[model samples]
Target chain A: MNIVVIDYGMGNIRSIQSSLLYLGVKSVIVSSDRNDILKADKIILPGVGAFGEAVREIKKRNLEKHLAEAVLKDGKPILGICLGMQLLGLSSEEGGFNKGLNFVNGVVTKLYGEGIKIPHVGFNQIQVNENSRLYNGLNSEPDFYFTHSFKMTSEDDIGASHCVYGSRFVASFENNNVAGVQFHPELSQNNGLRLLKNFIERF
Target chain B: MLRKRIIFTLIHSDGYFMQSRNFRLQKVGNLLWLEKNYKFQHISFSLDELIILDATRNQKNLSQFASIVSGVVNDVFIPVAAGGGIRSLADADLLFKSGADKIVLNSLQYENPLIVRELVEKYGSQSIIASVDYKSTAEGHLVYVNDGSKKIEYSLKEYLTYLEDLGVGEIYLNSIDKDGTGFGYDLETILNVKDLLSIPLIIAGGAGNEKHLLEGLKTDGIAAVATANLFNFIGDGLPNARNHIISLGENIANWNANS
Candidate 1:
């Protein structure tokens, strides 16, 4: 399968690439080239950094337009992980009010609740939706590694899996061909591998 | 629900991985020996996170360490946090490119507050971990840096507050006295300072067995427990401990390793 990992010059791209390699994917490309991303069978948006800076880098590299065209227009399946997932939302409150790629219907905001630690790090159980294509072949409640302060919430009927830290937040969302996970599936072991396989084969 | 974590720390020095005791290092073996003994590709399934720290006391090599990180992370699907001698954005960038999901900082959190601020601004707090090594004294817990060679003025509590204000993502508290002793964690010290933390806390040092790991994980306010004792957790040791911990009802991530 032709899998292209969108690189905006941030986050651990190597780990994602290594995970794909371990999964026996023969054609995984980490590139920012417009044509490479547009022609891929699937695209993985992987990021680890501030939303504003990440969005800025994406815009600077002109990946925003191509990504919109590839995922929104052509209906290619896209998987956004961690900061990449947050970048799919309408906006984020981190690093001031920053706009996202708006591929999914949501707003990223700081996690607000009493007695919860900031940057909620570690393995947390997620309530996976039964019909979620991203969670196919997984257990009812799967655990994924998450390390983020800002979380996504939506008013629309976006199929979201919920995880509670201080409050309920969108851990992963499925909206047609565009899917985003707040956790790092590449680092989440077997459950993660299963989820990524579902995205690659079932999506 | 956010579950607790069991982190495995690997101490790399020069071209060999070392076993540390009371902040003193003893060379264990090279990367080949490590791969043969630990087989991280299999053991990583039992861990929630992996932290690799370069503890070379003299003439630390950044590129070589990065290469080792890159080599070991292959096929080992788990969050890897690498640090040691990361002084610049380029160094952090190199580690990220090499496969580090998060960068752990020690001396720079004090020596270069501005760079820490820049990192926080660029990567956000969740991508940076502040590692504080301390030794308990008559006055209180005294913070140490530079591989525990230099002692800083701030007490453990004061230093943690400083780190929090500096906007680090998490705090890794390691006890210099209890390190590698197998006596279990210094739970008293953790309880004393647990209330002062606003970020996630990872406690390290003196974990020699599964019971010790369980004791650390069962404590309230402790987010994760880390062990760097390689010889103690070799072969199927880690997987067995993980199964035991899960059977004991501690909430940790479970996955089918055979799958």
Candidate 2:
């Protein structure tokens, strides 16, 4: 499959590409080029930096418009990780009030509660949605590696897998071919690898 | 619940991975020897995270070190944080481009905090880890930098606060006295200073067995336990330790059969 990772000179495209390589996806491309996005069989939006800066880079490379066309219009499956997931939402509170692609009906906000840590960094358990394509065939409360400050939540049915850090936040969300996970599946051992495999096969 | 972590640390100096004892590095073996025996690729499945520190004492050739890091972490699908002698963003850039999910900072944390701030701004706080090596002296817990050679003025508590204010994601607190000793972690010191910062803390140095690891993880506020002692936990040592911890009901990650 032609899996093109959207690299706007900001995301950690290496680990995502390697994870796909390990999962037996032979043809993977890490590019922000319009042609690569247009021709991609699937797009993986992997990010490791800030939301505001990431949006700037995406717009700078013209990935914003092309990605919208490829995913929204063409209906190509896309998986967004961490900040990439947040960028798929409407807005976030991190790195100043930021805007996103609005492909999914969600809004990013800082996860807060009494005695809860910021940038919840570690392997946290996720309670996947009943019919999540991203979390298909997973055991209950499966663990995934999370390292971020802001999380997305929406009143709309986005088919989210919830993880409680300080409070309940969207660990992952799937709406048809559009998918996003706040945790780093590339870093989260076997369960993560399985999730990626599911994305490649089921999505 | 967020599960605690078991991290395997690889200490590289000159051209080989070394076993560190009280900051004195003993050359263990080359990458080939490590692969043949330890089988990090196999054992890493049981580990939650991996930290590769370049302890080259001399003026560090960053390209050579980055190459080593890239080679070591090619297949390990875990959070890999690499650092040691990183002075500029270019050096960090090389490491991250190679495969590092997070860039570790030590001397730069105290020597050049502005650059550290810039890294935090660019990579976000979650992408930077502040590594503090402290020696329990007569005065108290003292912080060290420059490959644990030069002692700094700030105490452990003071230094951590500085790092927390500076906005590094996590803390890798290593005991210089307990490193590679195989005795145990400095639990007294860990307990004494665990509440100083709000960030997740990964305690390293002197984890001899699975129980030592369990003791560190069981301690309140300790997020992860790391060991750089090669001979102590070589080959099946790590996998055994992980199973022991999980069987006892500690919250380390457990992969299924197909996984």
Best by lDDT: 1
TM-score of chain A of each: 0.98, 0.97
Native contact fraction (fnat) of model 1: 0.75
Error of 2 at A53 (Å): 0.6
Please state the CAPRI-style docking class of candidate 2.
Answer: medium
lDDT for each residue of candidate 1 in A72-186, tens digit (9 for 90 to 100):
9999999999999989989999879999999988999999789889999988889887678887777778888999999999998788988988888999999999899999888
TM-score on alpha carbons, each prediction: 0.98, 0.98
Interface RMSD of 2: 1.4
Q: Model 1 chain B, poorest ten-residue lDDT window? A: B250-259
Cα lDDT tens digits for candidate 1, B156-186: 9999999999999999999999998888898
For all candidates, the clash counts are 0, 0
Q: lDDT tens digits, residues A1-203, model 2?
A: 99999888774668888889988898999888889899999999888888888888888888879999999999999999999998898998887897899999899987788876667888989988999877776788898899988888899999888999888989999999999999999988888899999999998
Report lDDT (CA) for all predictions.
0.91, 0.88
Clashing pairs in 1: none
